[model samples]
Target: MSQTRSSAVFGKRKEPHTIIIAHGDDIRHFTVRPWMAALCGSVLAAIAIGYLLATSYLVLRDDLIGATVARQARLQQAYEDRISALRTQVDRITSRQLLDQRLMESKVAELLDRQEELSERNGRMLPLLEKAAGASAGSADIPIPSAKPEVRADIAPANAYAASAVTNSAVAALARITKGSTAGKAGSASIADRADLMFLTINKSLREIESRQLEKIRTLTENAYKTADTIVAALESAGLEIDATYGSSDAGGPLVPVTGAESFDSEVEELDEALSKLDSVRDAATKMPIANPAPGRVVTSGFGVRRDPLIGKPAFHAGIDFRASIGLPVHATGTGTVSKAGWNGGYGRMVEIDHGDGLTTRFAHLSEIKVTEGQAIEVGQLLGLAGSSGRSTGPHIHYEIRRDDKPLNPVKFLKAGKAIGTLL
Candidate 1:
């Protein structure tokens, strides 16, 4: 009975650790220890705790990573926005710089065109001044001052100094911006502003130069016009008839088509024509016998119907006599070729000069004839010595002027010669 009681206690301990399993239409049984059951329950509980810890760790890690990524993205966007602002500033400044350059180029071209126009005006004015100078000198008694004066200007020098100042100022400003890199008012000024300021001053200088040049041109033109009119009046007073509006250009043949710069004005052309006409009239006047052959000499005999000096009766006198001593020097009265230089009927030692336009003069009753026949001679040339040789009662010279062998009034010519002496 005591052995049975001990087995029952052992079996009770075993029975607490026994395990059973039920299968389809079958039963299965297993034995276990109390410690094993406790170990299994502890393992399952540990696995559950480990799974919960792992899930919580994954959730916290994902949340931290998302927060970090969001912060980084915000920082990148801000950096991109800052870069975009800088890029926009640079692009705006560069565009303004290019626009300013184009404007500067256009201004320069306009100034150059004005300079060219001024040059053209100067060219046309020069000829008129020359014309006035020549006319006043030859025709007027007292010469006047000319308009051509030396000119000096300070545009270039002033511009150079000013440009240097502007450039230096701009450079200094730019250097400040670069070295300081300040976002201040001084640094905000851009290259375009500097360029505009510099060019504005330059343009003002150019305009000043142009204004002065224009004034010079106007003064020159007025002076030339006034002096030219004065010359024309003086020329007219000298007995030179000038067709004031005549142009020799039309007197020539067909003009060749010119293919060059047509810069000259009508005033210059008129001056040129006046100069040519003046030359022609001057040449003609010089060749004529407008000078006295014998100055301060008295007329001993008169031409036309008068008493002959030798025959002492009323007769036709073809020549006039000049009272002189023996061996007096005689001169030519006009420019011509000597037609005859020998003795003739009733006149000894004769000299006949054949002037142009059928005008002739006879110097007769001379002691000696110095010019040969057919020899060219000028007015006021010494011809021979005067003496009583033929048809003369005393030492005298017979002078006669004729046209185509017909006698003309010699007194008229002698008076004209004295009157025209001032001009020659």
Candidate 2:
């Protein structure tokens, strides 16, 4: 009986419990099973555990955030490294481009400098070229492009304009190339190559111009020397020795020894020397009394022993008489200063000119005296009218050429005048 009672207690302990609640006239009852109680306890335990887990998550939240941020930072660093690498590659390419552009620019600049130098040289040589062209006007071998008679009066304008055009073209080409380069255009290398070719062409053109100028100058120099030599020979033929130092008597300068390689300046100096020699010889020829005193006149009286027309006797005739009509113009034969322009003892209305180097010319038996004493005279200037004055027969004039008061034959002088005229 005690064992049964203990088993009943154990069964009842495992059975559901009933609880009742009453209010005034209403009553309600609920049966709570042992499983329900266990479920409730389990639910309560689950809630407590969830709360503890939530609290732990809240405590470690900052660490988790830090970890996530660290990962993001690493990713960002990797991305930044990649970007830097790309930028480095771009910079290298840019650097190479810059180097190439600079090299091209330097080459172009060098070419420009050379062109400018050539232009300056041309500017300085223009006057000389023009002078040479004028001196050698009939020369055909010299290829002076700008030496035209119509334009010879002004050659500088055309040449200067052409040079300016070339410079402008070069500047335009440079601008185009620079613009393309700045715009990062393609085919920059080809542009630079074209620029080089164009610049080379310009340089070649300038060289050709210079070559033509040099050729002209050379021809002119040769012709000037030839002219000088011919004049000297003519003077020697006329019994006049050309003084070597005729033009250098008053010239004085420092004796700077020539010490340089042959160049354009040296060539120009040689040309100047040749021209100077030509001028000196020409001056000497001019002072010689070798021109005809009275052209187109018949010589009635001769020099040396001649029969005098008035005296009807053999007399020493110091000059030749030309048959002329009264009031006919008489001209001076050479350039000189008149020393006598009055009537002399035997010569009437005599006009005597003192040419340099002891040379004198006399025109006598003139009806009129057109010059005064101590008057400067030139060749072909009218001296007086021809007529029969003193010791003259009919209408005749006596012309004389003397050296140091000694009479010389005028025939040889007139012949020399013809020869000199042909040469000049």
Candidate 3:
């Protein structure tokens, strides 16, 4: 029977069951578990997350590297630009310094040239100064030393020294002129050498006393020039010829020489004699009248055309008449030698002065003549008394101005007198 049973038809096949293990307990349960599917899904998810994270990290790293490279490149470019700018500034400053140096050199050269020119000019002026000194001595009223002694002695050596000095100065000036543009140690040494030479030559002829005298002469000459300028200015103010007032013979005339070399030589000889005479004349004139003869008076008659005082008729008046009392003192116009002091035809009790330069003045119709012929009279000396001694109606002084024996307008001379008086 047992055999017939036949394995019980699958032998009660194990009930479709799952083993559940909970808390270490195993139990048979008719259920299905999906752990394998869930595990598979979890594995897939983990793989995806890992891929995303790797991609993000790689991208971030690449971006950072690119940014760093760009920043570095920009910084490098900025530094390069700054360096170029600084180089340009340095170049400009160097160029400016060079220009300034060149300008300074040019100015130095110009100054040296000017100094040389002045030295040459001074050399030319030395002879003139000596001549002026000689002339001044002769022009003085005091006696002067004779040149015979100095000339007879050996003055040639002094002349030679003077000539040598001048030559050396000229050479030094020329050297300075030539090398003024140079600016090195050699140039400096050359300049110093030239300066020393010039100093030595200048001091060779000039003693301490001579230097002082020269300085005084220079001051006096400057003062004389100023005086002459003042005189010219005053003449201009008075509407007179400036040259005429300055004692120019050919005032307002052309500078044409009369003759050729022969005439020029003769003229030169004549000029030398004239210059000697002029020195004496200047001395004499300095003692002549420089002020008014009569005070508190006015001119009643002017030189030139006027009606005759005795008769009402037109006549040429040769002199100006000043109204004054009979006892009024008549004064000399300038320092001079009295050429005539006596009664004349129309001018009773007259006084005449020879003031050189072909100029003369006459005071007529005086009460008494005080000066004698050939008497040296000083300026402002009493000459006579104003009176109507000649053909006059009243007491007055008749003054006359003559040049080369010809009568000129006394107005100009009188104005000159007034100017001189004011100055005094």
Candidate 4:
């Protein structure tokens, strides 16, 4: 086999190897060509390279695994940090929202309190306003505003839970709206802001109402004063001097100018004073026999100078003659005590009442006498029935007002009565 291998090696392009195996007396021979040898060598080389590479990998396996693990750990740490940052940002946003909500709630509560106060004030002024309206002769009635508060509680949430309970989609929508533009933020109003504005408006309206009330009271006071002055003038014109100390005693003090901002209390006080004065004047005027004795009766003959119905000649008439029907109900024109109730010559069935302040009223030609002598009588009280008794030519009444036993024209008193009746 050595000699055959040595001879085969001498050939170059025709290189071939023979393998001979001897065992006992049997021999086996195999031929190996160059291509076959090369194939086997390539196969062996591939197997050797695989073994070396596997060995190298096995030697540095710890480093490779360590690098892989380190890289994975770094990635995990980065992800954790990002998650923590996101969580912190969410916490900050939630805290800020909570703070803003608390502030808004406080503002809403304060506004509600103000609204309640204004409502109460309006309620208190309602009666006074109604009184002013009644006293006004011809004016629009002042209407009281509704007492109910205009602000609603649901406009602003009372607690943080209400805000927190909002869904994510709703929160996002709100954020979009709030952050849309700077102009939107400036121009738009929140629920709390709207509530505050309503309260302010209500307060302003209440102030205006109070001012109107003051003005009404002032007007009423002026009217009352004017009415009193007119009554006094009428009394003086009819030769009746009013007592200087009629209502309140004369008061003197430094004249303090009234300020522009008049209070309701102050205006109401002035009105009451004026009303008292008016009442006193009216009372004095009524006692002076200024009221008509027979209202709605036609005066057939006026007092002073008239042709006598019986004589048909010029005569000085002491009283006005009213053409009244027989048995017509007659009322006392003034409050006084009956001094005479029996028949008198030329004054048939006369009823006389002596009022204080030296004033007396006489009703003659009565069909029936109801009041007795010394009986108390008030204005508009039933005195007797009308009839053409003795002096009267027909069914008529002779109404006379006398001061200090001197006859005065009854037309003057009746005219004064008509003028003062409007105020009363």
lDDT of 2 by residue, 1-424 (tens): 0112225454533345777789988987788877899999999999999999999889999999999999999999999999999999678656655765776577567656655655665666565555445444423322433642321323433454565577667767765765565433245556656666876787676555555445544555666666666666666676666785543456678977543224556766777777666666666777777777778888887889877777789988887888889999998888899999999967977999999778898999899999999999987899999988886667877899898898988877777777656444
lDDT of each: 0.61, 0.71, 0.59, 0.68
Top candidate when judged by lDDT against the true structure: 2
Per-candidate TM equals: 0.48, 0.63, 0.39, 0.59
Candidate 2's displacement at residue 335, Å, is: 2.6
What shift in Å separates residue 398 of candidate 2 from its native position after superposition?
3.6
**Candidate 4 lDDT over residue span 1-424, tens digit each:** 4333235665634336679988999999898878898999999999999999999999999999999999999999999999999999677665654554564455445445544543444444454444444334422122222442222122122211222222222334444433432232223335335434544554455455445545545666666676677777777676666676544566799977665334545766777777677667766776777777778889988888777777889999998888899999999987899999989888999999999777889999899999999999888899999998877778988999888899988777777767656544
Candidate 1 to truth, TM? 0.48
lDDT (10s digit) by residue, model 3, range 249-352: 45476676554334423433443344444444344335433345665679888889899989989999987888988878998877778999999988988999
Stretch of 10 with least lDDT, candidate 3? 147-156
Clash count, one per candidate: 0, 0, 9, 0
Deviating ranges (above 4 Å) for candidate 3:
1-222, 232-290, 422-424
Candidate 1 Cα lDDT to native = 0.61
Give all candidate RMSDs, comma-separated. 13.6, 9.5, 20.9, 10.1
Which portions of model 2 show Cα errors greater than 4 Å?
Answer: 1-161, 182-186, 244-262, 294-324, 415-424
* RMSD versus native structure for model 1: 13.6
Report RMSD for candidate 3: 20.9
